[model samples]
Target chain A: MAKGYLNFVLHAHLPYVRHPESELYMEERWLFEAITETYIPLIKYFQKLVDEQIPFRITMNISAPLITMLTDDILQERSLKYLVERLWLAHKEIRRTKGHNDLNNLAKFYYYRFVEQYKIFKREYNCNLITAFKKFQDMGYLEIIACPATHGFLPLINITPNVSRAQIANGIKVYEEAFGRKPNGMWLSECAYIPELEDALNEFGIKYIFLETHGITNANPTPIYGTLAPIISPKGIVAFGRDLESSEQVWSSITGYPGHPNYREFYKDIGYEADWEYIKPFVAKSGHRVDTGLKYHRITGKTDFKDYYHPDWAKEIAEEQADHFMHSRINQINNSASKMVIPPIITSQYDAELYGHWWFEGPYWIYMLFKKIHYNQDTFELITPSEYLSKYPNIQVSEPAISTWGAHGYSEVWINPGNDYMYRHLHAAAERMVYLARCITKPTEIERKALNQCARELLLAQSSDWPFIVTMNTMVEYAHKRLKDHIGRFNALADMIDKHDINEEYLEDISYKDKIFPNIDYSIYAK
Target chain B: MQLLKSEYYELPAKYNQTVIRLLVQSPTRMFVYWEVSDETIKEFNKNNQNYSDCTAVLRVTNLTKNYSYNIPVSPFANNYYIDVEDSGCNYQVELGRISKKKFVNIYTSNIATVPSDHPASYDLSKDGVLFGNYLCIGNKKRLKIYGNKEQYSRFQNQNHTAFENRRNGSSENNFLGSSDNFIGSSGNSMCF
Candidate 1:
């Protein structure tokens, strides 16, 4: 009469934006903020769990590109410098608010937290964050999964099957290289899936992958047990569908538990409130306010008078939210299990960065939820996808329906009218590269180099970020440039080969420039 | 291998009376052939450098083959492989050993190396190349391509400026800003 297991997966990803040419690009703040708010705090929580001898199991998907940025010495050094500056700014704010007891107390708390976290980041973790997650993974408290090389969208780019295959293969290679072992499951970029994609996943030796809610519910055979159970695809890979009810409670900005009146308001940062002249040191050159990680007020409420944020109160709210969420999940598992002939799994997936970063109390909530689940052993337990798959190997097989956790159930958000032009170019580039690869026989050294360069360009251009950027308009220009630069290089190389005036020096120069997929074969295009 | 004239290479309706000439070259001699096909030879044209038309041009240098036929090109039969016997520096020409249908197609063109005698070119200053420089194949004799010294120093300066801008919460016209407009768009537009 063991209770059903709850498999929780958190996906962590950010686009690569290490601006060696600019010391203060606003986009770079994404990584720093994630590091400060999400990564460092999660590590501390995991370490505490280990210290207390708690047997908590969690699954995480860390994208390869983020790992590359984390492991980079230059980025690490820059991040450390950035954190130190934040610490100093926090210290100043603590001193400035000395007369106001509540404000002063909150400022002091954040200042000390920054100082303590930075110490852990520098000394305990050596500013290399992956090792912390790896340590928990090694200790059996967590299972770490790999994601796409650059979080590239697989379904749309499956035009040349090899492009998608290479992304999967290369992703696994780099993931294993970083995490010290091969991953059991992979988080498909945006939970995007197509029937043909399963064949590629199976070919790459991936045993399990996750999908959105409808990907399973609306599946071809229409999963009889619903999202509460895992389905084995025709290709023998396990597919875990996300639970919508559980995800909504955490992902929704207005209704989510993080929006509790007691939690800190994510928007009311010190960067915008502090005096302009005094905060000039922290503002970017464009004068647009940016997140400085030092905030003063708790959410209070939608209409209530503002109250100074107290960490202790925030912790209480977190515990309450965790208890509520745990009870909801336990009820969900029980309700689902009773209806099924076998023990069901309730898979709750979320972005790892959501914890501690967007939702300040997220990691704590996770910690408390695990404790509550363990305490109530009769109703629920935490489990990883691998653990569940190993135990329930005889699950039903089905083909997941086409869907993504985007605007529509389809790829409209990532590939609609706003971004169609980018796709047109991408498709053209892919077709052309494939055509070029087929035409060459005994490629000269120059031809081989140019062809490889062309493949790299095509792959980079196909990255889902360019389209997302176009839709979001966050860094539309940068995304546009990336796509153009890569495609232009691809076309130019084609022109060089067509004219029989192959420029090896030029090819080598461009190859060194867009150095993604270093081992990618230009011959992939030839065929 | 047998060299049969493909029936899809028929002449267009507008050029029904046109007579196409064949030019086949080998080290020792050249052979010319003439023919007509009932079907049209409408080659499936892809802008890829590795397309059959481009590959045919490159392969012709060794053992060339040409057919003067009135048949329109079939979109599917766009590529053909030639077989040749190497006789010292010379080669014995053979035609149509491989067809597009039988061969796996490769669409990207091969990369050629920059010859030493070519114009002075910009060498990559960093171990990895940025996306901007991907379009720049060396040997631009007219434009002053930044050398390793200039490129590396400029990169360092830009990196410092970017870092400073981030530290101060500012967005300067550093490399990231300069390249912003071209980031998410498509088509043949260039970023500064």
Candidate 2:
């Protein structure tokens, strides 16, 4: 009867860059910008849906490190200050550029919106972003999934079984602390699916997880339907494969709705256009240039003069795009559902930052998409991963092929020659830390401090950021420094322990400096 | 009981160099501090006895030339305080409490050599600035120096040029006297 069930999953994450000592650091803006543009906006959309009785269903993966940062007092205060500054700047821009009707109007709109959002963020939630998302999860309007601690690229790091287990176990602990409940589903970083990865997920009681399209189609049992529905892993965990056709429409640069001529062009930003003197204060002194989040032109045309964007017009376009995407998904599910006896489930997963950071009208489009699906009962029904898995309990068990949701659908993006060098040291550190953890019996306070410092070092080194940074060649120094510093610290601690020496004060200082997991046990590395 | 023994060596008055040998008898990494000039120190090597050789030497003599290297210390390092006094042509140093198992080096050329008249009980503020009851070198030069309560208050207000001239022509000893005069309302001491 219905076109089939459509499950939308958004994975939200950013590397932790809280420098409490530094008043103004460039990398810290990553969280601030995401909070202002993506997280808060998505929360508002979901809250509105609940208030309007929209009955919309969405699954979101909020990584453990992100959750920690969201709940951190220093980060929360800085984010609020950042939002207030941006709002003030927007107001000033509106007044300064009063002659440009569209720009001025849009500026005013954003200024007021930021002010209202800041008030709601600070006053209502007491400046806590996690609580806002938890409210939606608790209300049953959204299903919040957890990711591995620090969003570690598990398949690559799973070189050892213990590393994988630690990632999963630590993730569950942090997720429970932030969300007040255990997660039912997990989002593997980059949708990197390995056969044994699911065992760890199942061990932690995760009922389902998402994967790339090929992970289902190329299943060992050979999925007959080919990513048209969810597949159950041998561990009894459900694997929802991303729908390729639907993904192409949203992710492809040439054909994606985000590339529509009316939408804002992401490349044209005030960072380059505005006077250097005026923008210098905002730009970091580190000699690296990053997006300043203020753009003045729309995509306009393939090769034409710039046309200013109007937020009102952009909202209208977003609605149209939402309608278009919904119809496309319906057609996709209808064609597949015709072949299967049961209603096929279409899983659409995307990076959450893409909504607001890349597509200015992304959150609006998502809101409208859910609205269209809710109204058109015959075409599609919005469902969470847990909801879908429970309804369709029977599924084919198989091991997914080695695949990732990256450019080539392979490991080249993360593990090529350019980045493989770091992997050797990373693996060595991981193995050595585990060895040390296991050999030590009844870890004293000093041993615990050293072990935790070693864990922090290994985890920071294990960050997908280092490899991605090397591949992109942006911030390669920073990524390299981070990896080396952590590895060096880990090695230093290991060397000390090997010689039967424990310097508690030095260990404690490093433990505090690189503190990420407070309750982390050194024994996790050992096992 | 496993005891970790560390050795601290005091520099000769005429050597203008200090070397501290830290021995970790229990076979562990040890963080040691030197109560000398704020010059940078480098670990030369570790012997079979697990003793590490750290060497510290003066790099610069004048206060004005040394002010530029006083950037805010990275939060990762352990910090220690030292007193600098102008001995007319050179500087005399008094070491403060050596931080335990913490490694932080102060570049003598970057900090104003401790003034000869620096007071007792240098109060290390919460912000990591050493504020003495009298004139004291801050994390930075002249502008950050706290001679008295009033000057410290003014420094907190970010009056950058407040103590600039005193940093240049006046030696560390004259700098202390200048602060005293300014604090005692002796004359309209130029802010810079």
List the lowest-lDDT window of 10 residues for candidate 2 chain A. Answer: A392-401
Model 1's CAPRI class is incorrect
Candidate 2 lDDT by residue in tens digits, A140-206:
9889988888778876677654898888888788888888888888888888766667557756877
Model 1 spans with C-alpha error above 4 angstroms: A285-287, A303-306, A436-454, A492-527, B1-192
lDDT of 1 by residue, B16-96 (tens): 211212221221222222222333122223323333333222122332222221122333442222223321122222222
**Cα distance off (Å), candidate 1, residue B124:** 63
RMSD of 2: 28.9
Q: On a 0 to 1 DockQ scale, where is model 1?
A: 0.01
The window of 10 residues in a row where model 1 chain B has the poorest summed lDDT is: B111-120
Candidate 1, true inter-chain contacts retained: 0.00
lDDT tens digits, residue span A237-303, model 1? 6789999888999998779888898887788887887789998887665677777888777898886
Which runs of model 2 end up more than 4 angstroms from their true locations? Answer: A1-3, A285-290, B1-192
